[model samples]
Target: MTDTLIKLAVQAQFRTRPTLRSVVAQMLTEHLQEKYPPLTLPVAQLRLALPREGGGRGLSPLVEVALDYLASGIFPDLTARDGLDAYLSDASGTRLSFEQNGTRHYDLAVVEALIRELPVIVQVGFQDALMAYWNMPSDAGGSRWQWFAGILQDQLRAAAIRQLAGDVPALQRINQLTDYPARETRSQRHGPESSLHAYSVQTRLVQGETQVTVQSSDLLLVDGKQVWLCNLSGRIEAYASLDAFGQALGSAHGRPVYRRQPHLATL
Candidate 1:
C-alpha cells in the first residue's frame, strides 16, 4: 500500500508538470515493469542506509527516496557515468549510491544536519553564496555540482572554525573588529622556505535599498616574501613585505580611527 501510494503521488506530480526527463523516466519504468515484477520494498527498507549523527528530525526516508528518484531521472548526467559521485567523494567526503531499481541516492540528511548546526547568519551567508554560484555563466566551470560541493565544504569549514574559536578572546576581538559574520584563519608550511598565512572574512553591507555581501582575505605569501590585502571594496593591494603592508594599513586615509585605539588602557 505504501509503495502504491508513493507511485501514485509521483505520477500525479508528473501529470501536473510534464517534462522530457519525467516522460523518459515513466517510459523506462513502464518498459522495465513488463520484463520484471515490481519491487515492493517496505518503507523502513528504503530509509537511508547510513546512521545519522544526532538523529535530528527531518524529511521521512520515503520522501527522500522519492526526491532522489526524481533527481536521478532529471539529472542523469550527474550520476556515476558523469563522475559526480567520484568527484564529491574525494572533495567533500560525500558519497552517492544507487538502489536496485536504479534510483540514485545521496545523504541529504548529513548535509541538512550540518546546515542546521550553523548560526543563522552563517546560514544566510551560505544561501547567498549558493545563489551567486548558480548565477555564474555556464562557461565559468565544467560541473555545477562539483563547484557546489566545493562551496558547501568551504562554508562548513569556516563555520566549524568560528564555532571552535568562539570562546577565544583574541579571535573574538578580531571578529568584533572585522564586523564579519564568519572568519577563517589558517597558516600552512610548504617545503623548506615557503609558507602561507591567511585570514578570510565575510560581511554584508547595505547601500540605499541594495544589500551587498562580499568576502575578503589578507594573505602572507611565501614566508612574508609578499603580502596581499583584499578589501571589501574589491580593492587588492600587494606589498613586498609585512612591514610595507603594516605601514599602508596604518597610514591609509579614511581608515576607522577606532581600529588604531588600544583595547586595554596600558596599551
Candidate 2:
C-alpha cells in the first residue's frame, strides 16, 4: 500500500478519537493482517518473546518501531542501546509493563539490549523491510507490504536456522563437517563466512503413502566436493557431491523418484 493510503487510514481513525496508542496499533495490525498473511505466525512468535502484560501477548517491537517511523518520518536510532531505549520510550504510550511484587513497573533495557545485539545481517534485513514498505518503487507489482513481509520472513527464518545450528544435533554435526581444516583456517583469518544454502526436495514414498508428497525443504552446505544435507527430522547426511545426493535419494525402491530444486538462501 502507498503512504497516502496509510495516512488516510490514520486520519480516518482520528475521527473516532480513540486512545492514540490503541488506535495506531489496531490500525497497523489490521493492515498487516490484510497485506501480509504469511507473517502472522512469525510475528506472533516474536511478540511472545517480548514481555507481556494484562494477560495479552506483547506487540512486536518491530511493529512498534515501524509505527514510530511512519508517524515521525525518522527511523529509530538502533545504533546504540541508549538510543533504542529512548526511541521505544518516546514512540508509544502503551508501555510493555509488568507487575513486580504488586507494583506496576516497566523497563526498556532488555528490549534495547536485544535490539543492540541483533546480528548485522538481521539488522540490515529489518531496515530493508521497513524501507520497502515506506519507499516502495512506483513500478513494483503486488502489494509493497507483501514484499516487506517476505523480507521479514527471510530474516526470521535465517535467525531460526542459526539458533537451530546450536540446538539441533544434526545441524551441529553438519556445521562441523562443513568446517574442514582448510575452511576453518580461511574463516579464522578472514572472519567467518556465510555457508548456509536452502534447497527444496520433492520425494514420493510409494511404499507407504501411495500419493506424491512434498517433503519439507532442507538446508544444504556445499564445501568443495562435499555436500551436507539437514532434513526436517534433524537428520544429517553427507554426500560426495550434489549428484551423489540426488542418486542416494533416487536409490529408494518401489519405483519412487524425487525432484530437487535450488532455493535462494535469502539471508
Give a tens-digit lDDT track for model 2, residues 1-267.
344664565354334333434444444444444543433432222231233333323334555554455465554433333222221221232433334567343334544333343332334445554554445432234454444434333443444465555657435434343342244554565457634343446555454434555564665656556666655433556788878876776674674354433332421
lDDT per residue as tens, model 1, 232-252: 322345567766655554453
**Given candidate 2, what's the lDDT at residue 12?**
47
Task: Name the lDDT of candidate 2.
Answer: 0.45
Residue 202's C-alpha lDDT in candidate 1? 35
Task: Give Cα-based local distance difference scores for all models.
Answer: 0.37, 0.45
Best by lDDT: 2
Given candidate 1, what's the lDDT at residue 244? 68
